[model samples]
Target chain A: MKNTIETSDRPVTITIPEPEYPLHTLSVLVNNKPGVLARIAQVFSRRGYNIESLVVSPAAEMDFSRMTIGARGEESGLDQIKAQCNKLIDVISCYDHTDDAVVSKELALVKISVGASSRGEALQIAEHFGCKTLDLAPESLVFMVTGDSGKLDAMVGMMQKFGIVELVRTGKVVMTRGNGLT
Target chain B: MNAEPRDGAQTLLKCLEAGGIEVMFGYSGGAALPIFDALETAGTKIKFVLARHEQGATHMADGYARATGKPACVLVTSGPGAGNTITGIMTAHMDSVPMVIISGQQVTWMLGKDAFQEADIFGITMPIVKHSYLVKDAADIPRVTKEAIYLATSGRPGPVLIDMPKNISQGPCDAPLDAEIDLPGYNPEKAYEIDSKDVEAVAAALAKSERPLILAGHGAMLAHAGPELKELAETARIPVCNTLLGKGIFDETHELALGMLGMHGTAYANKAVCEADLIFNIGSRFDDRIIGQPDKFGKNATIIHVDIDPSEMGKMIQPDLKIVGDAKVVLAELNKHIKALPTESWLATLDGYKKRFPLSYKIQGGLKMQHVLDVWDRLTESNSIVATDVGQHQMWSAQFNKSKAPWNWISSGGAGTMGFGFPAAIGAQLGRPDDVVIAVVGDGGFQMTLCELATAVLQKLPLKILVLNNHFLGMVRQWQELFFDNRTSGVDLEGNPDFVKLAEAYGAKGFQIKRPADIEKVLTRALEYTDGPCLINCEVVKEDNVFPMIPAGAALEDMITEKPKHRMEKPTGST
Candidate 1:
């Protein structure tokens, strides 16, 4: 349904700039309880902010879990969201990858329909992207790839010409690269 | 002095009463059996209505909230039970109705392992609900429950979820009943602080502009500022245009009132909005639907947007003056700053346009939806509440019926959910038992949740339902006929059940109006019998279309004023 409210005729476009540096991830420790995720989400939702990717799992210790959240917002909006998360009782700690040393990886599986003419080209593209063939059906090939979300997105975009039949992505899952597991 | 050991379930019942929740709608399932068991043993004051389906439970809660303006609660089991409530949650969210949805999850230890009937209820509902939480510790139940209710009813109201694990419900905890939840940044009444200079600039623009228009939104209804808005518009003698969600805020029959605006808006209303010199927007988010192609919208006018949320000020289309403040307070202050101006010439210009494109329907030979709205106008008091489902019927109700009071027209505006009318009417009826409550639904929309008729019948609530039986998804078919080469796909209802029989099955009186002559008599009979719920199914022409339509992607000035020659080829009976 539409609103018939009058408005100004002049076109106004506000272009939000991309981050100055490469995108980063955050590892957040929160209470593994009901509503904790919601509380964390409320911090973003109430501000009309959007999270690019989020993955939640149990932490090394019981009664606690970790969520790897990826987002791109203006500096102040991001700061406000992080501060809001810190105030929730269930949240133990939050670390921005830009400020702290962390490791992030994303996994994706792509099924491509390849005819005889495109089979070799599709395989070549997969090898170029370091993707392994998971399944080789008579008419299709499934490739499994793991990397940062951006790299995976690029790989998917490159393979679109081969006629992607299906795509499944396990969103960005991150940890502290090595030796440090919180 | 040792009291009987209380389980988490009993404690939950105690907390519910303490939190002032009088009732809940839910069904019993394996995961939620513990709570039901506790209810049986504890003999709590809270009443639980057993719903046939989880969706029904959520709809009941939605109705209760709409009626009472309080957060009504619903309970469901883990996994599929919880998943079934998503559509209703989305409906409530889209309509901005307040509700607290509680779903039982698997035991805490088995949460991530894909246990029986286990699903990520919180994650699944994240986008739909206002806020969703999973309660891990039994001790935090009281605080979470209180906070959920508080959050659901506060701000731009919507659904909130509380997913409790089975173990938490059966666990032991010692927490005070008044465990305060100090949510550091939680402030429900936070209004955006608008700059004084912006307000002054808008006031100056309004003072100077000869053809200033006032546009109201759902925010105006939320703030209960309808009276203040009407006063400001009438005092300033400015024309008022309303969003679909903002309908009924101003008397549609008023001289200054321009009918609902947007894609399906009347020609005169859309023309006025598009051509105004200065537009004062109050408590509305300028959604894309209202301002089609923002770049070309309101090019001739200056927009002054006033909203409580600061981000909404320039989120979509930029405004000339952006003021972030409570709509009521802002309108009252704007009223104080400006004196009544003579808009006789502007009114005359609009009146001429209104006369050129007056809203009317042919009274040829059979029952028509417009005729039903006309009867509704005569039968219902000014304060009567009218709820509508999403379809061509909803548009008809908005266009043909006259609403004099704010909130009297309840509908799923943003979401456009089909099954909202029946339950919302029940809620509105329950909210104000002294006033008449009517549900205006289409044949397709009425069937979406016709089971709610049992809720009204069992509760002995008097809700009059007027179903426009076009035997097709009227709106979709209209679009298909107009834009899609008339290739009707999944729009026709070939084998639908008899609605009168369906009403009879629910123990409600049913009236069928098949001819133009039967409209007044059938409506009078339905209005006369006020003992229980009733349904009036008016079998309108199956191919009838809503006219004066602005085709999709078309500007307001380019509306289809007359029905196409092909559509008029068949002389379908009308009223």
Candidate 2:
């Protein structure tokens, strides 16, 4: 603590504690311009973060786009990423959505080749998860599923035993439950 | 053809003229033909300096920017022209010099086809640039130019690259010249916001600590925090040690000034840092060269880190208190509320260290670099702007050439780029026409950008080129000798062009100093050459190592103050 050359009555200790978080979900808004994705990706890649999942779509405004990014990092690194993203000229805003009340969803189209004995089991599993059958064949099937990321993960986990030929899923996208921006 | 050519090239020149850019450096090529054509007709206000190489052009602009505290301009063609400027751009980027580089590209349709004279300069310079634009549409020229200048020169200044394809610059377009700028995400004004409570916290730290020090860096120079720092340091009685880039922010002769700290820093400065209980770091990031062992640096102290960039806040040594604002603004506010500390005992203790381990050189060493620099310093008592290339001379000049003006010392601090000194001196001379500028270079490093002698001669800049010619890559050779068992390789410059004759060939004055007695006289003669730029090759001793060295990755406490008398007895260098 730095006291006055004359005074010795008061002193101070300074501390700015930064907490760590297990996961960071960031919502970003940027101009609907070219090369925005590459710009945003640079921020994460430079910090050694593999953006585990990313979903981008046109926002309500015609000239803007919204992006949802999911990555695992501590608070400092996450703050740094958001700060750098905001520094970009094209970016309008970047905010952490991890601690907000929101509705999130992911969509997946899964193709699986089931043997005759496992065919009925696969269909039953699909039916339980409320997946719509996109295509059906004697030995193969494609199903479209929409749900929260956890539900999709669970469904995909159970169907893995059936030997999924291919799986493509949209990354998680979120909107606040009430009258607030994601 | 259409009713009218869009003519973005004319508009680009007009915008640059409106931006108040008086001069620019560049090389003409195929992709840039349109801009050059526009320049030939439209550039009544701008003076363009033709550089032989793009790299030299970039560094020249860098030095101009640093000297004038304004955004300098550069223009280069696509492909190799743009590629050559990477080192210069990164150097300016690291040192936070404000510059805008306009690079021409092939037509838009040919962009990714590996067309002749094409390179992905936009992507190449992204990491190094403050911002970049591909500028596909000619209509966006005015707005982008304004925004690029604003972004480059404002908050935490850096180089901004604008890559213009041939189609956009040459083809017809009808964008208006006057345009308003808007960047929703960029907030430069935030750096000026300082809360009173934050200032109070800083005051409290100064009050409570028994021993405190101010670790100044290049950012301090950027913020122009010299007067405020002087007031506060005088008010608070804190000793200060600057980083390499932070060299000229504070007057080095002040009682509170502990020269520089880190590798190749003063022994007294390093010693003072290890014993301090509180560290007030302003503007300078904790670079590896400055803070060797990250965890150990300021380990015993409470650190308050102040920077304009928020992201720089926990990037290195985690601060006990982080205040995000310009150092100038923050220090001014802190000075208002903070009471001066009772640091008499602390000052006395540091003064003892200074007395015990002062920076010294052996006077009898055969033609020492230190002797040349020290003599030059005494001979020219004026505060000349010193730009230096990386080498033993660079370090020695930093130690010896004591300039008092803020922002007078320009060097490639972070990039450690050679070939920077000579052209940078040219740029500085151009910017500061009244002030003397000296380029302290090494024999090995001088050859890298000596091609710019033509540009220097044409400009007739009153630049003093001091080449400490040792006939070897002395810094590397010193490393090989100290750490690698003296097995030097690939460092001998056996066929160097006679530098004096070379300078004369370029239509400038030249001088050579071979003995200790000649250093002052030759350096004086070099300074007296007002007709044009001059080069002085001071042939100094080889195999000399910079002492008071905290070897790479070593903590401040472990810095060696002297070279061993027995060569074999030197401390084993870290591999």
Candidate 3:
């Protein structure tokens, strides 16, 4: 075997990944007011930015609101918007998570067509994705899955190959990875 | 009563007076002649403002209602006279203004025989009015009159109608004068409460989530929850987005402001909304315009919906936590329970997006409409009220005009009415005399109610008219270019008369602007003139269109950013 091996052989190659656009998760603190949202929306509207998943509620200890905004944009523009928001009397603060650590997850409910023939495969897939069968009919099955948006989307794509009837998704909900409350 | 004096017409006038109606705008007609004659002879307390047109009369009454927050009454005769008030009635309905329109009908004997100058006025106005009543007997007159006023001024105010037969106005019985009418299932002061369990669930979710988005709608405006919404967003470090109807609810100048979200939303705002991790909807019904496709919307986030209307919750998109309550109350309680969260990274990301795709419009190397808006912005005070007719100009004003306070911007939102601004401006101006009033109308829209100039002159109202004359119905032309393959339909006004002459005819001064240089000076002159009403028609290029347009039914991201390449295709002869 050694005598038959070639002298020169190609090395198994592993390419280094290129630098990517920074992903950021932001928590926007604002006043719950009419037109306040419009004003905030105008900032994104005029600029043509895309928001990922957003969650809003009032803070635990104040008379203000909390908005969790996920988005991908250049660093400078995001900074300008944050600064602008901070200048508003109603805006308490804005936190960007691109440079900070955060935890985020998304939830989805999918209704898929599962005939008797595909029932076993559908159940198997649902079990693998940690999804619960919320509604199980003779002809169809509805599964509820909670996870990151990407994970849910992947599961949905896998299920789509069989047959999808309808789907409902809750956008992403996020939190900081650390214990910093402010 | 001395011998129980019984004149049918006089009795009707007395009933109207008893109903607490101080004034009425109307025109005389055949079937209504007796009522008018009785009004003249009885010397009733009610004053009358005779209108040249029935439409004008209705609008005057509408103006009175919007001004006083009371149901203003209008009187019209049978047949076409009653029909003429339809446009004004529709206007009031669309804007949710309160008005009571009374129409005289043929005598009770000839009610349904298709008599001359007779019409099924009640049936015709049914869809347009909140309620319509047909007076069959003289005994029902007093009760109907009071009920009509009450219904018109009640919850979510709108127009109400009372059709008076000629004989009913004359025939008499014991006056049905009482302040009470039992209306079942009409709860004007209904209050909604949030479920405690749902509030706790939402609080827990907020405590855990890092990135959140708040979407506010017109319901917040109606609820007067702007302050609470602002407080919640700020304290929680959440970004906010708004729908078109909710434009002024949040201050646009806020840093966390994502601008308007929907088909016509700014690119940044749409992107932010689409990419948000959690979407909390407040006082908004997630209209299709706001959400492009439910499957594609908030694809990566949990949606928390809070609304006063339970039916609205989870109707469009299911929420992780559905809190049914008034926005103000829910926001207040949520604020008390949620701790402050860090959103520096989120703010930084939004800021970057804001800079990369700023809201920009082109000038076309000529007189820019921005200049006109800028001039108005400078001259008008914060208290100065502004109304706009539906078109590119209205959007432009919405985009440019900085309203520092509430109720300063009044326009037909859902209806997108073209001829609304002229009459509405008159009404708003009349309502708030001390506040400066300006109506920004397009040339096409202005001509629709150009007759109202006479009303302004007659009333001696110092209303200012800023007509952005592009010689076309700008919005329709834009649509034609975008959707109709550039076939400019009936949208141009090339052969129209000089507006200055028209204004002079109505005893008002008019200023015309064609060149870019004249805008500021003309606006200054128009604003300075404290005399009678003045019109400043800025003759902009005929083909210019508003940019950053969201095509109908498209996602907010698919906005038209620059000027369209098509240029009128040589003005298809005689529009």
Which one wins on DockQ?
A: 2
lDDT tens digits by residue: candidate 3, B1-575: 44455565676677677766777888889888878888887669887767767876776676566545555678899999999999889978766667888899999789779999999897777657766777776766666677777667654567888888887776664664554664432444443455667777888887777777889876666566888888888888888887765666677668778777775566677778866778888877787667766556676788888765544555567777887666777777777777776777877888888898776555556665656786678766434677778888887776666555445666766556667788777766666777778888888888877888987887777888988888788888887876678789988788777888889988999898878778778877887887879998787777766656655555555556675675423222112
Clashes per candidate, residues 3 or more apart or on different chains: 13, 15, 123
DockQ (CA atoms), all models: 0.05, 0.42, 0.01
User: Relative to the true structure, how large is the alpha-carbon lDDT of every model?
Assistant: 0.77, 0.86, 0.72
Ranking of all predicted structures according to lDDT, beginning with the best and ending with the worst: 2, 1, 3
Of 1 and 2, the candidate ahead on lDDT is: 2
Q: By lDDT, who's the top model here?
A: 2
Looking at model 2, how many pairs of residues clash?
15
State the displacement of the C-alpha of residue B232, model 3, in Å, after optimal TM-score superposition: 3.7
Per-residue CA lDDT of model 2 for B1-575, tens digit only, reads: 33334487878888887887778899999999998898886645788999889999999999998788877789999999999999999999888899999999999999999999899999888788888989998989999998888988889999999899999999876777778986776888989989888889888988999899999988888899999999988988999999888887888888999988888988888888899999999998888888878878999999999999877887778999989999999998898876678899999999999899887898796899988888877877738899999988888888888757686888898899989988888899999999889999998878999999999999988899988999999988887787667889888999998999999999989888989988777887887889998899888887688988887877889788776554544433332
Please say which candidate is ahead in TM-score: 2 or 3. 2
Residue range A1-182, candidate 1, lDDT tens digits: 33122212222222334455345467788767666877777777787666767889988878788898877656656655665565454677876776655666899998877767778999998999899999998788899999977799788877766666777887787766677753
Shift in Å, residue B242, candidate 1: 1.4
Worst 10 residues of 1 chain B by lDDT: B566-575
Most TM-score-accurate candidate = 2
Tell me, per candidate, how large a share of the native contacts it keeps: 0.00, 0.59, 0.00
